[model samples]
Target: MAEQAYTVVSDSETTGEEKTSSSFPEIAIGIDIGTSQCSVAVWSGSQVELVRNTRNRKLMKSYVTFKDEVPAGGVSDELAHEYDMLSGAAIFNMKRLIGRVDTDPVVHASKSLPFLVETLNIGVRPFIAALVNNMWRSTTPEEVLAIFLVELRAMAEVKLKRPVRNVVLTVPVSFSRFQLTRIERACAMAGLHVLRLMPEPTAVALLYAQQQQQSGHENMGSGSEKIALIFNMGAGYCDVAITATAGGVSQIKALAGSTVGGEDLLQNLMHHLLPNMDDLFSSHGIEEIKRMGLLRVATQNAIHLLSFDESVPIDVDLGNGTKLSKVLTRTELEEVNKEVFEKCEALIKRCLQAAKLEAEDVHDVIIVGGCSYVPKVRNIVMSICKRQELYSGMNPLEAAVRGAALEGAVASGISDPFGNLDLLTIQATPLSIGIQADGGDFVPVIHQNTTTPVRKEQIFTTVHDDQAEALILVYEGDEKAAEHNHLLGYFKIRGIPPAQKGVPEISVCMDIDASNVLRVFAGVIVHGTQRAPMPFMEVRMPTVDDGHGWSAQALHKMYGSTLDLVTVKKIQHRDC
Candidate 1:
């Protein structure tokens, strides 16, 4: 056997002396990387300490550059405050694009964000467009994430003077499997072990409910006030859930969100104020002025301020005190932000309707996410709540991150897991459960939108006599074609005996865990049906198909040592 050496990717087990620096072997940190700002907080012992910038400010601009090397800004360790210093940078609206199809509504909306759009194409991926034109250097979404993680870890490292190990990450419920995988890999690359990934709304609920209980409040209502809705709107994304509070434990009723958030509203405001910015690409070449990188940011700040009050007097520091000022009235900005309100309203209504509650039926309205600071946004949510007693105390920007840190504390054993928290029920994604058919229609074992942690089995048969193996590909999403939608994974059941056609029965069951990650199992239904039924196991995943990874022996049996590239290409497409 080859000499074995295992690397320590996570915390040391309980064999050693208790770690004195942290309550748990692994120190816990929660990072909220948002569009306008990113915040990193640590739950060391008893209190949570948020790392401040040089000026003792809490928020850090989610900006990173990749020129000579990747450098980041907005949270300087230095003692100076400068926003314009850069090497070649990209900001955080990238979160809005994660896990989206190229044509998604939010992807379209992200283009309207206050950043330069790079049209230059470099890689085979669309993520490249940001690089070739120099709006941001060519960087993968995962790489961008790695840079952010590096900066955060450095900040914590400076504070502790020791390496921080274990962490829990929070992703929006909107994340697809690939995006989640990418995030996990980025953490691995950054030399941190991810203990778990809690969805944003769920973490927020835990944080909110826990705090309420600490203040001597529980089960905020009996039967009359059974449920409350969380309206989480931020600059980069929006999430809303109808959480039921029985004695103050918030449980998810149903949840939904999108890449479109307050930033989109800001863009809408910009188009109203500066019509010229819309023609930025055609009038001025993208590479030149796009690299200047300040026009959209100035406008977005003005728009964000307007959300707080009815009107905000705008100031754009073009340079040398030559400032441009204009007053954007509530009505004018309202016309621009109408699309955002409608989308939010529709999602909220859908969630409420699914929970079988009318707008007036919901009891308490808890608004969160920084975007909720907008006066008009508060008004809209209040109208939906239809009750004066609704509590809107939580700070949206800080709430999710704080909730995430609390979850981290619990996860890493720094805090007690049995500690009381508000638990609410929420809707599952894709809305239906089904198996694929020959013609592409979904034969639902469980209907779409059903509550999850569900297991429904489907059987498959061999198409050919004397078949030794079978392939079952599972998928998620709403599409008429098998080629479209998300292909979660492909399963291969091997070691079957030669049998007549349709003799073997393959059972496929899928289960969603508490955290909602999916697992798939395939096995022979009966021991005699094959030899011994393979034990039900995990969801099979795909591997990168780099031809070079194969060994010489396997390669020789498949093909001769020297082969034509044309023949290899032919085999790839014509394997069947």
Candidate 2:
């Protein structure tokens, strides 16, 4: 095995300005880069149209193969056989690994993939590699994603006969703000500028809104508000959203997401068939890699078959005197992945509760995504919403990308004569953004499911006597404990002027604009004064990057609550 050098386009060499079509009428494209598949669509003057590759396939496998001297992605690369993709040379599931630390459970789960995923169990980026020329070639998730995006861009350019620059991408709601930066970085690396990143369910809500508006116009009736419960479960994530739709507006009332999906189901069944699967693949020899790939292909085929059949047979012959034979029933498959189904149900219920809506209030129950084909997944969503059927207006696989295409047109200022372009999707925060206070407790200023383009503030007081400075540790998540959540960044509010504990007032404000940018402001005022002692500080969120987990622990170890602050009460402010 020998090390090989590969040259990639660096982002520093590119222009810093986000390329827009302000000079010319260019429509941004919509792309849905899923864990297993990817698609690109755009508005073709009058309506949204899906773009097809040279192979005439609309959905391309999301992977990058390094078997050749030059890396190739699924967008243009064609394999002789499906087994070739699982031969340790193709890297898939980059979506699950992007922006995740080594200590993340999701990163740990990704170790089972054919490619090399090495983690030190520390809060840092995991090491990923693909087999090329009999040597393990190192790569980052962001780099692999960028390579794939470049291919997608090339294909779109060839088809549309125009330069593809601006794009609207759809991401899972569970993605953190730091994770979003990774996505933007990948786009930048590919020389593409992202106009917007809509949550998967919210994009679907936009498409639904347009449908409802058309229906209202046809009936010549008032465009009444319709409450929709949307459940989206793809290969790597599951998301739930409750939206209020009227006319052409889709106002997202609540959003909940989790890292549970089809991948978990496949892995569970693979392990069920071979209990010693992990132990067998630990060596990573050529024979072992082949054996693992064989088992994976057989298991994947069985799962897809189970979607339409009562039972599917999985048979694979792994060389070195190993063989597997099993008849997998649909019920057995559901039982094996019981936790996945339960999580999907829980997300929907949690979203409904957050929106303060009952199951009866849902006028339409929509299920979309790759896993929506599974009987158990569909049943769980329908049963939770107490509906006999799901809304079948859009394709399960193409709904998200289609909605993204609609958004690209709308954001690009394209107008349709039939009012199809008159639409908007008002998004909400998918996770609560707050600070650590009251001894490691998470006190949220902007709670989850709160409408975005919002500004809210909370008042706090010093926790210790004679405290002149207070540390504001920003975090994001729904956890009650601050340490369990994702740390976005931190700052200090000083010049409090010597004061007794719980006397001085500290105003911490959080603002989210229409573009989904987050800015945190902190200021302090003395006990007997109406004005602050120092100027207010405002910092954009997600300042911390890799090793954020370690940073949070180190911050606690160094300060040890010396600069802690406790909650006083909410501040009365107008939320816009």
Candidate 3:
């Protein structure tokens, strides 16, 4: 590469404040705030530039400190990769608390955190986890999130030198609307506007497909069809999606997610440490584990070993001559985690059924996310999927964030999404969908697993004489009774003279539009007219860390981290 001599072409027309595209920043960043670690990537026109936060050092600790000087100190302006040996402080796994209600199963499970928990006890033991609280003030989970958001925003701001705002946050598919709302609020509090809420698996497909298509190797697989199964296993969740490929266009066919992630598995191991080890959260013990790099590296190594060979050694630092370190065979790992694996298998099976395809129908099976690094999980999936081929070895931990960056790029016009589409098949039911009867009975117009972007209609007569209006209830799900399923909303038709019952010729129609929003319309003979409203949807789980009298069983993991904002035009993963 030779350096070319630059001759400044002094054109008098070119003046002082030149407004060129280069002067403006075209970077889009994706933040994958996982339970174990947090990652973000910037799309710098060429490719995704991924980096781990040196301030937080690891992805995320999911612990929040109240009024602690530690979490609120010395983050250098420069990107220095130093582990925050900050003790007497709290910060870890905020992802678990992103969007949650008082009654999510995961929330209850957070009780064993070893940190002092506080907050209301709405049946969830740990209302919230706070390390330090000002005498009169306790930190809200939203405030805890404020810290993580500040850290992430700082990274983007430092790199861009401009305020970074818009973002596409990915969440678990199982997240409910209420949960999503809390997360969105968190993001809002952090000054970042959520452009869209994408599911974990979908993000992976978008990232993988974007790379494949951009490299001019779009059609790299057989059947001359473009499709991939994104198997995303992570620290706190697992997501599987059947993404179709068209010129790198991705659409989610069927998606399945679970709160049971690699971190959960690690946490289980940590429980094993509880028996063998006693020095977990001592004044300097946790820091010592971190300083020795044993906490992070050992955790990953333990996970890796258990997933591979028959067993591996477990080291627990039991101060004063009681060294607790022993080999744990893979068999023992499986024996201890049989139920978790079984649950994962069941979830995957359900996803397959939803896709209406056999395991063999999958074109490409790619594994992403941090957890899939476990060999057994991959092996079992291959066996169950009955597939001979699988792809791994990519940076699974950051793949989702990278792909998210690409999506952000496409949204920013820096690159075209080209339907490079991170295809997410909306989970709409019934092909010729219709609602239920008033008597708590089911009216099946369409069935589940029916490919959507569809339209269907049904006619109903006015129930009463002189009836000028009629209302119809809209619903979703596979229950035999109308009340059992989720009510999508309602359809109302106004304007008809009061007539005999069943006299008004009223009709109702349902449409799943391009953006996956469901539309409900009603019509009556008023110069022959019809009107309708739109349908809705995405991520996060919140946790309560305080020792509230509330029990997790009552809530059963009903945390509201994911919400349906599809119907609402202005969408944001607030407080996310």
Tell me the tens digit of each residue's lDDT in model 2 across 1-576.
Answer: 121122234444433323443465678999999999999999998888999998999999998887666778898655533665557888889998899899999998887787788889878899898877778888888888988898999999899987777899999999999899989888877878899999999999999998888877642346578999999999999999999998889999999999988999999988889989999988776667777778878888999999999998877898778888778899889998988888888999899999999999999999999999999998888888898989989999999999999999999888899888889989999999999999999999999988989999999999989898899999999899999998999999988877789988898999999889999999985445466689988999999988899899899989999999999965578585
The reply for model 1, stretches above 4 Å from the true place, is 1-24, 77-88, 99-124, 129-136, 160-162, 216-226, 246-250, 274-279, 282-292, 312-327, 415-435, 442-471, 478-484, 492-506, 514-516, 523-576
TM-score of 3: 0.68
Estimate, for each residue in 398-438, the C-alpha lDDT of model 1 and write its tens digit.
77777777767766656444444233334354334344544
Going through the candidates in the order shown, the clash numbers are 22, 0, 85
By lDDT, the better pick of 1 and 3 is: 1
For model 3, how does the per-residue alpha-carbon lDDT over 128-175 read when each residue is reduced to its tens digit?
433343232234555555556666777677766655666877777655
What's the lDDT for candidate 3? 0.55
Whole-model lDDT values for every prediction: 0.58, 0.88, 0.55
Q: What is the lDDT of residue 533 in candidate 3?
A: 23
Residue ranges of candidate 2 with Cα displaced over 4 Å: 1-24, 78-81, 218-221, 526-531, 569-576
Which has the greatest lDDT? Answer: 2
**TM-score per candidate:** 0.75, 0.94, 0.68
Better of 2 and 3 by lDDT: 2
Q: What's the residue-level lDDT of 94 in candidate 2?
A: 93
